[model samples]
Target: MNMSEWLVRTARRVPDAPALLSGENVAASYSEFAANAARIGGLLRTRHKVEPGDRVAIFMKNSTAYLELLYGVWFAGAVAVPINAKLHPREAAFIVEDSGSKVLFVSGAEELHSLLASTCTVHDIEAEPTFAAEGAAIAAPEPRAPDDLAWLFYTSGTTGKPKGVMLTNANLHAMTYAYFVDVDDVLAEDAAVYAAPLSHGAGLYNFMHVLRGSRHVVPLSGGFDAVELSALVPRLGNVTMFAAPTMISRWLTTARETGYSGEGLRTIVYGGGPMYQADIEAAVAHFGPRFVQIYGQGECPMTITSLSRSDIIDRAHPRWRERLASVGPAQSCVSVRVVDADGAEQPPSEIGEIVVSGAPVMKGYWNNPDATAQSIKDGWLWTGDIGTLDEDGYLTLRDRSKDVIISGGTNIYPREVEEALLMHPAVSEVSVIGRPNAQWGEEVVAVIVASTDRPPNPEELDAHCRSLIAGFKRPRAYFFETALPKNNYGKVLKTELRKNVSGL
Candidate 1:
């Protein structure tokens, strides 16, 4: 099935139902949104000469127009390349050039104007989305094979240069299925807010909600703000939004201060980064049963293990805390495994790289055969995440494959130590990294952001770790910083952190 068909089919079913919103106001109905998409698609085909399989990029922030452009691109039988609005022009230009996109839909971002003059044609989104009614009318969404490219997701380039991950129509179909089966029981009345970047996981979920004829809401702030989100809870009832773990933590703090119980929130599907056990438990205590945790990568999008709300509140089980600490069992469609260096499966309680094989997996990296070969082998995506699966099939992630610390022949996962440090009352956010040491080979180091007015000193933090984790895993040195460097996705940049402590 063509992904764009979801919008067209649902519009036919519920023509007058609200389909898109900007803040508290209704932006478009199902019928109107479909008509606009058809008009834009018609323009792309007849006027712009966009052919099937061509890449059409959208370089705009989260708004009503962005969503329409995404659907219109697919409707026109072209692949959508959604660029991060936060990226520099040079970075965005690289993706436009690499994808060979002939046209770009952009807002009035001064940085992106240079790219319009260089490689691709540009369309300003601030103007009314009106197209001449003259093209061969689009009767229906153009047909394409299941494996044809639907989205070209460029990684955040934390480890290296960003590579375009080719997500297909079939991959998105599997993702939508996993959403209904494992994520939540979404309803037609449920609404999804786009506070997170639409270019990333937040935008990918547009189809899943659109499939149910739910509302796609873009916050008025055009970005995430805890204060604004709390106000919108009751205004937009039964709301669900995908967020990073850091955003969840910040929102919880704001909720407490404002006495907002998240009265209308249905679920907050958090995944982009690790949600520390201490932080999650606190969030659940405050927000009630409204959290679902997922673990996925760019290669697979958001179809991975999921920890449901029932599992979060299920305290009667003997291993409830352990299960809560895990990213949960694999989803219905994907097969997950933990394998050693030679692709051999690891036994329970042993750490190995997490690999996935399923329909949701991407085709390959675009125009990069070497990266494609390294990431996908035998139809399995090597996720570069180190984790273990328990007897109950629960998956516990230790750290990224590149983030492990080897100290005196004993390997230590940073997440283990970071979790311990987070238990401290004074610690707000913490990132653990390994620094080269001649004596122990690589020493564990903790870089912290203090939560309390009176920050805990190194001596106090050292004793705190000794009481919780193994002494060898305790930080050899502690550095107090106002904040840790992070990417747009809220993951702590351990690579930059490592560079900061390189001379140590």
Candidate 2:
């Protein structure tokens, strides 16, 4: 059950099927892709001495080569450890050392030679001699069991040091199946563009497309560029791309300037961070019924609830707005619940910690049993997200548990405050955080990115929030910036924001 087995199957079914693309041009066919993977797999076993359970890390950005190396490692029956390309060299090195990777593949080996003191062999994927030179292709991929570790994904260390989440072959198989049954369907004619970071959810989504022999597009920049996608999508018709909320916002801005109607764009599976109501509504109005929202974490690797295209565009339903704001019901394979601090199930409409138990949930954090036990209690992965579930089973996210502000003992979720601020005509993007106050404990403060040169004053935003939310929920202070600090996946760095606010 090595994940690369899917690539082999696609190659046999559609030898001539288009596989990888760079911009508008075809980079490899299905047969060619499989062949290259086999050869690379052979090289790993023969030359690099990678064993079945060994970890091989890929630290490169989005490219056809990245995918090739990823599958090649799996084909060799080794676990693929993908590092975020946006991380600092030191940070990437920590993951390499912690994962105990046998080899570290990178876009540039020279930069990491000094930073990484580990004995792991480093190879530049572009300059690897065996990628082009003579190498025996593996006749068949090494066998793997269902519980065998296929990927070791490290959580983004926004809170503390990253812990590797071990994802097994069975977990991935369930996630891929859930995509078709709950998420959007993929066609052989569809093209999946890698605009979001491949080390995250966007890369993990390659399974469904590969199973159907769909085309994969790696942007030349190896990252997001709305202008590039605006042109590329039309060139490659029937395109589907995973995006973060921030990327979607940038696309909306670019569409306004370029008048691009999202022609040839089939579906956008957006996740990785909280997508506010105002932003999602605006996207649907412009792009029509082409957006799907998924809510999951590194522990699950994108198999949670899915907000369907129909649910997103359904304006006629009596509860459409409320449903639209939700992440939809639990996906086919998982059981979701909202529970109180004492682990008791909360009634409908009561906010609590969201927990999930399913085939897709990670077995545990790699080499961190204590952390794993703390996170997954009684078989349910305690997703540190604060949310409420309605009677119909739709889950509405409030905010992260850490992001909740206890002002005068009244809990105020930042997402609620941000959503209210975004309702204002002048506000483009906003993040609300708690500023420590001596009297009231923690007071609400907003960090805003304005749409126009004339930013909304604190009084204007205060009045707008009052109409939409409770009096105490409105921000007591406002800080306007050109943009909010975000991670590679476009999640607002509230931890970083809080550090700055601590100074204020």
Per-model TM against the reference: 0.81, 0.81
Can you write out model 2's per-residue Cα lDDT over 124-209, one digit (the tens) per residue?
86675446344588898899999999999986422436689999999999999999999989999999999987888888999999
Candidate 2 local accuracy as lDDT? 0.86
> What digit string (tens of lDDT, one per residue) describes model 1 on residues 1-504?
678899999999999999889998998999988887887888889888999899999888899888888888888889999987766565677788888887788887666677544557778766534542444557799998999999998763334255899999999999988998999977899999999889988998888889899999999999798999999878889999998777887888889999998788998998876677888898889998899998887799788799988998899999999999999999999999999989999999899999999999999999989888988999889998999999988999987765656554333668778887999999999998898764345789999999977889899999998766557778989888998999999988888999999796
Superposition TM-score, candidate 2 onto the true structure:
0.81
Clash counts for all predictions: 0, 0
The number of the candidate with the highest lDDT is 2
| Runs off by more than 4 Å, candidate 2 | 129-132, 157-159, 403-504
Q: Which candidate comes out best when scored by TM-score?
A: 2
TM-score of 1: 0.81
What are the clashing pairs of model 1? Answer: none
